[model samples]
Target: MKTEKFQTILVSASILGLAIMFGCAAFQDAIVPCYISPDALDYADANATTFLPWTTLFDARRIDRFMDFRHLWIQAEDNLQYNFLKGLNAFHIRGSEELKTILFSPTGPIGLAFPALAGGALGTYLFSKPKDKRKIAELEKENKK
Candidate 1:
């Protein structure tokens, strides 16, 4: 009986450990940036360099227009990447935080309690009933005869 209980505990622990590991890997992959292109950096630098010459050659209005265009383009690209990473990071962080909250809340251990109750109930139901007692008894009597 003790060995069986120990095996059950080990299996439950292993399953929980696997779940945590999977979650961690998924979160890491999702939040890490993977789509950055080298050309985008080159373009940004070129725009900045081109704006410098315009400030000297063009009148204030024309210079202002060029500068405004450069600034907007740079900002748009940066904002796109920034917001993408921010959203991914936020989703991953929120998932981890939620797991932590469920595991270590002040109220109680909500994570383990539900699983424990479910397992206990299932085990109880499975083990409570005797297995074909009348058949076993009849077979024993026939064998004795």
Candidate 2:
């Protein structure tokens, strides 16, 4: 009887947790501001290196602090990437050579697709799995001690 009661509580908590987690669309919860300065053109030229390496894009101290581990950072990074590419394309369409170099360079759109696809897949996998009773029972046992 005790075990059954524990199971009921466990299942209820799990449902609540999942509901809170999966209720909002992952990237839709907050706005991430993305900007490209026209003044950046002073430092960026057709021959200038606009793309920074991934490591340099994030701060070393922040990396040590594990800033990337948070969902907010992940979502913000995705928004930044999407906005950057979208801005570049918009600029190029309006005949901006500097943006054209950045947008249509040798690298192309391959890099852009990776993160968007990976994040979508991860969110899908996390939300689609049903709660497992085995894991719940194990957790309940741990809490009893």
Candidate 3:
């Protein structure tokens, strides 16, 4: 009975954890990254304008420059790319930092442990051999005496 309850908890935790991970990733990827706000409207004048590629990754956080380099790609399918490959360089720099952290940190494997345990628990629970019914029956009879 205790084993059954533990299996139930493990299965429930695996499902919930995976669901949250995927949901958050989806939300992050689907962001449009550019939009006008009510505050911007209030500040707007007859001469107000937004040049191309000015809308940044987070528009709500700050106002974009009046006329700046193309913010399009960061690869815009049909727009001017960043001058001198600066955007690509920035991307590689950030990726290098991430790789360094994962490679150097002992705790990197800590992130991997969750899915390992969750999957192991669920798989064992599902594929494990059943206990002998005869043994359980005999034990119960002995207890009754």
Candidate 4:
């Protein structure tokens, strides 16, 4: 009875772990479009115009490299900011102050949940015992015999 219970618990935990992994993967995919849109470039361009004069301090080659580097840096920063705003917009769209609190607040559970849930799911999947271990062992023993 105890062994049966243990098997049930293990199966349930494994299923739950897989579900969490899939949910995390889906969440990541959903946010990717928000990070990669051309609108992010427009946002960066508008913000970077303020700092354009700083590039003039360098020679042409150096100025070119600096602008290239600066543009990439600004675009990356803008994408991050836009993704955050997109998440906030999603929360507002859902009419969920709960998600806003979870995502926007410094003490939000999302900070802990994302890493912990992902880690737990990965650990469970990688460490779980194979279902056919005994069969393989028996085959090996027969081969040896």
108-134 in candidate 2: lDDT tens per residue?
564566666789899987765455667
Which pairs, if any, clash in model 1? none
Best by lDDT: 1
Give the least accurate 10-residue stretch of model 2, judged by summed lDDT. 41-50
TM-score for candidate 2, residues paired by index: 0.21
- State the displacement of the C-alpha of residue 49, model 2, in Å, after optimal TM-score superposition: 32
TM-score per prediction, in order, is 0.32, 0.21, 0.24, 0.27
lDDT of 3 by residue, 41-109 (tens): 345321223333534334433343321222342246343454447778898999999988886565676
Which regions in candidate 3 have their CA more than 4 angstroms from the true location? Answer: 30-145
**TM-score: the better of candidates 1 and 4:** 1
Name the top TM-score candidate.
Answer: 1
Model 4, C-alpha of 25: deviation from truth (Å) = 53
lDDT of each: 0.66, 0.58, 0.60, 0.64
Cα RMSD (angstroms) for every candidate in the order listed:
38.9, 45.5, 40.0, 43.5
Q: What is the lDDT of residue 92 in candidate 3?
A: 94
